[model samples]
Target: MIKFDGIAAFVATAEAGSISAASRRLGLAKSVVSERLAELERILGTKLIQRTTRKLSLTENGQTFLPRAQRILREADEAAAELAARSGKLAGPLRLSAPVSFGILHLAPALTKFIQEHPQIEVSVELDDRFVDAAAGGFDAVLRHGAIGDSRLIARRLATSRRLLVASPAYLEREGHPASIDELQHHCGILYSMREGDWRFSTEHGWQVVRPKAALRANNGLVMREAAMAGLGITLLPTFFIHEAVKSGVLVPIDVGARAEGAELFITYPRDHGASAKIRALADSLQRSFGNPPYWDRLAS
Candidate 1:
């Protein structure tokens, strides 16, 4: 008989791409996960994985068995959830991923309150700007801005915030603000490195794009915001990042009669995650915390 634990260990290791990562997700020791994988192979009388120092790959047999194993685990998890729900108690480990700036500035406080309310749930959060596969990375959920690309994940929009053209008073005082979108070419720009420095706006005539000359470029939003606040150059940033600065008079918005586009923030999870108790609890708390208008935008208003 194939033990459920052995099957779960194999599935996690396969998806996570390594024993160490799988162990972290399962909250199990490396030795335990390795032993379970080895035992699963022994019971089946077949080698299931090819392990080298650099990486782990599934053998042909392992590849064929992976989907079936995943199905079995999903069914088992659903069954367990049903029982847990009956008792009105939830207890499990939840792994989450989020972007660095938002995670630090926003998610941290929300997570603190969530943990306090649900003492039985063990939570782990990984903050990074790099895109991660939620299912393969073993994350229960992840926070993202803008559209979600993966078809296998379901996204729930938490809130929406507009991007604004902003600069320090000192910079605007010295260089002067551009009177129109066409004149933006003459000014220096602090830009987010991941995106093309193309600024888009809604004008009465139609939409317009301005590819600004970047004087300073950084991958992180906080870095770009800091540079802009230091009188480096003008930057287009999400209101959530600079709303306080705009309110405090540290940064001022430059309205050139162009309406900025808004971006939606989402909490996404794998479709196969199947009504996870911990995920549902955290999602509810976050939605309520952010509210409809979002607290930051309210502060800005």
Candidate 2:
């Protein structure tokens, strides 16, 4: 019979990149993790991973079985979670990731109330702007802005994320607002340093690309927003967090001749965890907290 402990050991070792690392993650002794891996290899009558002092790599057979192993663990958890659902009591370790800005402005508050309501549940959150893999990171759920590109994950919409080109009143007054999308290309822009592509606007004809001259560039949205508010240049920001500034007339939305393509606030999880009650609970809580219009978007143009 296949021992789940051994399978888990093998999976952890492979993912963690070292037995010692896996031991730390699993809270098991390194020797115990090694023995379990050896036991698993013996039971299979084959070597799964090849070891080296410099690096450890999975053998061909191990690579083939890795996905199957992950599936097994996922299904096992789903079974236990289904049972917990019947009791309607949330009590499990929930790991998730979210973008830093959204995490700070909105997610943190929602999570505070969620954890208060489910004190028995344990929650771990990672706040970063970088892309996080639900499967690789072993997250129960991940909150994200924009679109879900990974087909392996399931996405649930929490609220609208409307991105807009905005500028301070002083900047527009000094530089003169663009009369149309085409004229926007002539204005100075405060851009994101890690921006993927050129600025895109949805026009009457179709989507159009307009790249403006750069006056300032930043990697963080907060920094970019501050620069725009300080009369740097026009920049694109999500309405969810910048709505207050816009409402107070600190920044003015530009609608020269087209609309900026916006994104949605959503929660995503690995398809394997589709049946997890924890994911459902968190998603439901976030959706309810944000509501249809989202509190921030109330006065946003």
Candidate 3:
């Protein structure tokens, strides 16, 4: 009979390049890792690795065993995950990631309420504009706006984010509003530096591109909204962050006749996390909070 622990240690040592490295990764002592590997070699009646002062090299038999060992470990993990899913009890740390603006305006409040419900679950959220690697970074879920590039991830549409060309009524009165997309060249624009140097729009007439002279450039969307509200210039913004401002008459939409390409909000996680109770609970709570046609979609309508 082959011992699973010995096989796991052998695989880890192979992947990590040494017993010491494997021990660090597995949270075990180097001696334990070495003992497991030796036991595995004894069972197989073959020396799997040649330990040298300079490096660790795998023998021919080790090369053949590596793939099989990894497969077995993966299968065992999958089986454990399936069993955990069937139990239906969520009790672990759940890591999440989201964009800066949306995370603050929408997701933060919703998460606060959900955490109150599941007090046992520890939640950690990372807010940034860049996309997070959910699997590698240990994030259980991510809330994202705009297009998702990776085909490996499964995305569930949580909301529709309408990007409106808007400015304060005071700014419109003082500088005159852009009646058409072409007229934007005459007005000062608040540019988001990360969106590249130009603004691309999809209209009924096909695609139109504009590169307006920016009076102020900002990396953060909230600051851009503030700049626009302070009568700086016209800015393209998502409804999710500006819904309250639009309703309260702080900001008014401009060039409404020519609409820009609206972005979508997705609640995405690894396909593997689908079976995790903690991930599922958080996802369900989020859907309940923001998924009913979404608040942003309602605002746009």
Candidate 4:
């Protein structure tokens, strides 16, 4: 009979290239990982890894077996999760990756609430704003806003994030408030993820585009928000990111005769996984938590 723990240890050691590294990655002691590897080799009557003074390398058998071992582990995990879900008590691990700002501001709370509801669920999260390969990262799903550009992943719309033009009261007091879109264009703007252009809004007439002077630019929405709060310049950002500041009167909304284009928040998973039971449970939790129009939108109103 093949044991999963041994296979897992072998796979980790093979991929990590050293027992010590695998131990840290798997949260197991080096001796334990070594013992598991030896036991698996004993069962198969083959030496899997070559250990030397300087380095470790996989034998041909180990190289051939690595992919199959990984597949088995994945299947075993999926089976356990599916059984738990069918019984109406989801369990096991659910790993995800998300944008740093959304992960900190919104996703973290929702995850906490769900975990509290299901104590047996073990979750691992990676919060980053960069585009990452979900499969390569080994995340069960990803939380994202904007286009899912990867055809390899399936996405579920969680909510619509509406962007609004905003500035600190101090910024408005310093720079003078812009009463219309035309006037708003005259003010230098804090931009997110773009170097040359600034604002894009939807108005009663049509889509309106403006290229304001770039007061500051960054890849992160939080950076732009912080810049706006520091009275650097007016910024158009999502309500979720700025709602609390706006509600606290630290930032004020500007009616610039158009609505800044926002994005649809999505919870996506690799298409190969086919929306596993555990992933569905997490998605449902997020959808319920966000709600229609989202809580942030209501608060901003």
Candidate 5:
């Protein structure tokens, strides 16, 4: 009979490239890891790894067996998770990645409720604006806006993020609102540096693209929003960020007789291993919390 511990140790050691590294990863002593690897090699009657004082390398057999070992470990984990889920006792660490603006303004509150409901599940969230490789980053899931670029990932649409062209009431009153897309070129713009300098709007003829001269260009949405609020210039922003300002009459939406397309917010995970119960539960919680129109949009309306 094959010992699962031996298999696990072998896989960890092969992946980590050294027994010392694998021990740290698996929370096992180096001697225990070496014993497990030795036992595994004895069972198979083959030396899987070439160990040297300077380095570790996999044998041809080890290279061939690595994928199978990984798959077995994955299957075993899934099976355990399935049983725990069936018993309604989901417990595990769920690591997630999300955008900075949305994480701070929206996801933070949702996570508070999620933790309250599922006390056994431990969650670690990384808030970043840059694109993250969820699989490589070892994240259980990632919340992202716009289209999913990686086809290897499974994506679930969480909500639609509507954007609007907005300016502070004082700014509009002083500078006067542009009546058409062409006239927007004459106005000062507060641009998000991450996006294209040219703004696109749906028109009766077709899509109209206008590049406005930027008075201020910023990477952070909050910074751009604050500049716009200070009567700097007209800016394009998602409703999630600007909704409160709009509702409070600090910012006024510009009626250019055109609408910008809404970006889709998706929760994406790797397709290799299906989502675990804790991940599924977190997704469910976010979906329910966001709702159809989303709580933020509804509140603003």
Candidate 6:
């Protein structure tokens, strides 16, 4: 007889693309996940995944069995939900994902409050800036910033963050500030490697784009903030990350009245499960916590 636990572990490994990722999502130890996968493969007498240093990829047998496993699990979940609904109770582990910097600066604090309010719910949060596949990752919710892609995921707008140009006062003193938008061409920029060269802005002449030479470039927002604070160069960053710094005079807005392409913060989750109470509760919490027009939007340019 095949063990359902082993089979479910295999399915999670296949979907997550790595044993470590599956372990984190499932709240299992790395050794346990490995043991489960090995047991499942032994029972089936076939390899389920091609484990590589870079990532785990599903084998032919694994791919063929994935949808079947997912369907079985979904049915089980539906059955449990139906039974639980009769008692009118919400109980289940809720998995969530969010950008690393945003999670550190915003979601992490909110989660502390959420956990206090809902003691019955168990929560797991994954912090990464890379685009996440919620269903594949087995996440119940994802907090993302930017234009929400037109997908099956249900995205609830949490707040809007304005894009602002900022630099440390020291940098301005040393490098000389740009007097106008046109003069920005002569100034150095702290480039965000993730967005790289596709900067859009709103100015007196309306929308404008600039490709400035970067004195430094980094992939993470916190790193960019550090660089800017150290008087590196002017950077176009979301006000959410720099508002406090600017308010404290650690950083100053460069083009005071200019606007830029802003991104909407969203709480996105898989639509396949419809809206579960877990999803709704977390979404509502986020809406209440940051939805009242985030302080970033009110930052003085």
TM-score of each: 0.90, 0.86, 0.70, 0.84, 0.78, 0.82
Residue 247 of candidate 1: its Cα lDDT? 95
Worst 10 residues of 6 by lDDT: 77-86
> Could you tell me which residue pairs clash in candidate 4?
none
Residue pairs whose backbone atoms clash in candidate 6: none
lDDT of 1 by residue, 1-301 (tens): 8899999999899988899989987889999999999999999999888999999999999999987887687667656766776788666667789999989888899899888887777788999998877755656788898889888899888888878899999999999988888888889999877776347788887778887888898878899999999999999988878889999999999988788777778888888755577677888888788777888788766
Clashing pairs in 3: none
Q: Least accurate stretch of 10 residues (summed lDDT) in model 4?
A: 192-201
Question: Once model 1 is optimally superposed onto the true structure by TM-score, how far is the C-alpha of residue 69 displaced, in angstroms?
Answer: 3.3
Candidate 6 structure quality by residue, lDDT tens digits, 1-301: 6788887788778777789878986789999999988988898899988887877888898889886777566556556655555666555667788999989998888888877766767787889989887655667678887777747688888888887788999999998988666677788888878764556877767778887888888878888888999998888888889988988899988763566788788888766776666666677887777756776666544
Highest TM-score scorer: 1
Candidate RMSDs in order? 2.2, 2.7, 6.0, 3.5, 4.4, 3.6
Candidate number with the higher TM-score (2 or 4): 2
Whole-structure CA lDDT of model 6: 0.78
Task: Write down the worst ten-residue block by lDDT for model 5.
Answer: 132-141
lDDT of 4 by residue, 142-204 (tens): 888787888888889989878889999888988898988899768988888643454777888
Tens digits of per-residue lDDT for model 3 on 37-87?
Answer: 898899999999989999998999998988677657655654554565567
Q: Which stretches of candidate 6 lie over 4 Å from their true place?
A: 1-4, 16-57, 74-89, 203-206, 299-301
Q: In model 5, how large is the Cα lDDT of residue 235?
A: 90
CA deviation > 4 Å runs, candidate 1: 24-27
Over 1-301, each residue of candidate 2 has an lDDT whose tens digit, in order, gives 7899999899889877999998987889999999999999999998999999999999999999888987787677667767777887767677789988889988899999899877867887889898888766766788877778898888888898678889999999999988898788888888877765547878878888777888987767888899999998998888876898999999998888777887688888887558488778878888888877777777686
